[model samples]
Target: MPAEGVELTPSPQILTKTEILRLANLFLSSGVTKIRLTGGEPTVRKDIEDICLELSNLKGLRTLSMTTNGIALTRKLPRLKDCGLTSLNISVDTLVPAKFEFMTKRRGHEKVMNSINAAIDLGFNPVKVNCVVMRGFNDDGICDFVELTRDKPIDIRFIEFMPFDGNVWNVKKLVPYSEMLDTVMKQFPSLKRDQDHPTDTAKNFTIDGHEGRVSFITSMTEHFCAGCNRLRLLADGNFKVCLFGPSELAVSMAEYGSGSCLLLD
Candidate 1:
């Protein structure tokens, strides 16, 4: 989070539950089976449970997942799980509490940890933990994250820091996927390669005795654009077709009806 904070979008401008469902249904009908509720911290929404319920109940929607910081997940996960939230990816960049505070500019290290445990306790098998690895920062904690999977069925995913607006992204800070993999292999030479789905973003691996697995989202170094099957919808109903690619092709849900939106491709 930026220290000065970002300008908030007005409530009226953001897509309402009904509008979100309409778009979700439209996408479902178009063969989009998975829908992930990502954020600026999705748990902050007052009607998040309601949103999850409606989305999860949508026909043709196979998964209703979320990517959250996990600050409020401990209290929210049970309700969210009841509402049919299928999967979770909790972002905890570092294991060190002090470094977490420094990186996020907040004090929620314990809360995030609690949230991860809460998800695991609630039968969220193979609960994923997303760690954005930056050189000279939390990159040193790579093995520490891997250790979390020793007994628990967690998927510790190391993501390469990619350039984004206002993130002050630099090449120096970027830790490539190969480098990360090599670092892990040196510590655990017996790490075995795991099969991945054709469209899976992360290349997976598993340790012989560990309950969980490890993977790397090699967006910066190894582009998965060819087999990419992801789409993003902004809060204001704008469709972001690609995460790293240009948004010149962005389409607004307000301007187009369901039929037109589906025909956009």
Candidate 2:
């Protein structure tokens, strides 16, 4: 779950607290144990803390988390933690300031780094960093990113760049999974795979005696089309069943009169 397109529509209408609560209840009734809130940037939402608090009180939801770009966590993390946010996944493409600017089209490397530090200080244990590996771009920064958190508790994951939003995707721009592992292994001889979280997207591995871990997501090079159990709801209320598929289900809130119409049995 990534929060990158939460504010797609002009003056987007955020799902109200009542609607969020109802949706949580519906999922719980269906025996779903985990729920993640994602957006183009979830922390940008005005009442994010309120939504987290409401979802935390749900009966059967055992885990609650969010995926953000780490731009606004400095001010919102404490409140989110108090409301039962146990884990966080932050997106970071490159450590080099210039490359980062080119990748995200934003000049906030310092701000993002500050946010990561603030989240760790605020007790976001086991914080994870997501880096999308693009060939001929930030692929050189893989070792630097791994070294930054090698002795810390952070989990750094290398994601193979994929085509989304109909962007032009090319194999030449993709750094394969084998190449990514080779790059890391050349520097850290003690790294080994961690088998605890088997279903995770990235293949989990750790520096033998260190607290930090590294992973690789082979979405394009190797597809995990099966065993993917997830759903995406756009800010405009369109439900996307597959991130790569063309199928879409659009539910008009105006027709249903409220958020209750989104309930799934």
Candidate 3:
């Protein structure tokens, strides 16, 4: 979050490649089928491609995807794709460059735009665009985002503003799923509906005459927390069982694949 005080960690404590692979193999062997690499920005990791290749080699691993800001994504996409990167979920709030700069407080909208096109150009299947919908902010650009999906196989996903720390969140900024759907439906009245997956966070629909999909994430207005086994790994080698929660529990990769897990189930 830009509003939060951003600082570079000095001598950061993160798991190495061997440890990461160990953890991955452990989880995969224990019924973890899918994996998506996310971060403050996973692209910042110089060894990301190496990490992708090692994990992709696992026979039990079904898919490998990533959520990135797309600012530095173009040059890395082809290599990552070749190494078992199945799909991409790029964050793009608005099509307008000026507004984008305003929201992200960065000067890389053009680069991000090119990155999106690059993913599509490189034949990335179903490229996802994660747009955080904030009312009186980037909400007006909803139709513009939908327009991109007309010719491309992109999935424009509208995520409601979540109450994360340092994000200056408020109920007024929450863009409900119903309202998001209504806004898009006004422009695209005839869209094909997609069946919901058991663990899908997005409510998906496709433009009737277009080649892509659109989805809305309504976590704020609706609760989907029960029985969700979402265990997130933080940047500094900690496990956050619930991402919105304040506390983080320590988890070590040292004993990850030693068959000594607490849950014997």
Candidate 4:
């Protein structure tokens, strides 16, 4: 959020435990096989481990993943892994400690690095590191992030900055997908494009013999709208088929009575 935005209100309207599981189960039959638990900070939830445990038990679900800041993963990841947590996407923008603090206003950069290593050791397939690429900000670390994929099996993803409510988006800060690729290909001439998975949001690649991989999530300059297949559930029980569209067609998960809330195209 920008400094000029309104004060953050405490939303006391999140869904209950039953509602989350119920919602998860409801979609399982509809071919929604993956459920990713996220939050303003999901690890802050006291019941996150239990949530993962329950969702992992859902019969038809193929994957249960999470995207976290990784502040609390050092202690919780082992249990989360045992409870059938499939993978993780950890967010860290800058490699420099000073810049990390300047960007996130937090001092837990080391913890995030620890969590990334810990996930790799614990067998989280392709432990992904998400870097939101901004032109004058953490963009300098693009190659540095890509270097991680050379030896280890971590998948480093360069994400384009996106505009959402309350987020302070600067058009000048945007680094297009082409720029990121050009920068990497210039430094690492051995890198070659990998075969793509149709539903994968990121365009992936790998080096000649590197254990890991790299990707560009080109949501801005080269939008992948034509191949999009996504749905999102908000913290407050409301859900949406599209992440960019204005909030609409909310189903009240607090009280479970539902009709077709989303139109399948």
The TM-score leader among the candidates is 1
Model 2: worst 10 consecutive residues (lDDT sum): 256-265
Which model, 1 or 4, shows the larger lDDT? Answer: 1
Please give the lDDT score at residue 130 for candidate 3.
96
> How well does candidate 4 score on lDDT at residue 233?
73
User: How accurate locally is residue 98 in candidate 3, as Cα lDDT from 0 to 100?
Assistant: 94
Per-residue accuracy of model 3 over 76-167 as CA lDDT, tens digit each: 99999988899789998989999988898778999999999999999986999999999999889999999988999899999988988668
Distance from true position, residue 216, model 1, in Å? Answer: 0.1
What TM-score would candidate 4 get against the native? Answer: 0.91
Per-residue lDDT over 88-168 for candidate 2, one digit per residue giving the tens place of the 0 to 100 score: 888989888888787776788888888777777877767888898988888988999889675677788899888775445
Per-residue alpha-carbon lDDT of candidate 4 for residues 153-205, written as tens digits (9 for 90 to 100): 89999999998776778898899988889999999988788888677789999
Rate residue 65 of model 2 by lDDT.
77
Per-candidate alpha-carbon RMSD to the true structure: 3.4, 4.9, 3.9, 3.9
Residues 150-229, candidate 1: write the lDDT tens digits: 99999999999999878889999999999999999999888888888888889999998999999999999998888776
Q: How high is each candidate's TM-score?
A: 0.93, 0.87, 0.91, 0.91
Model 4, residue 44: C-alpha shift (Å): 1.0
Given candidate 3, what's the lDDT at residue 188?
90
Model 2 scores a TM of 0.87
List residue ranges in candidate 3 displaced over 4 A: 252-265
For model 2, what is the alpha-carbon lDDT of residue 118? Answer: 77
The window of 10 residues in a row where model 4 has the poorest summed lDDT is 256-265
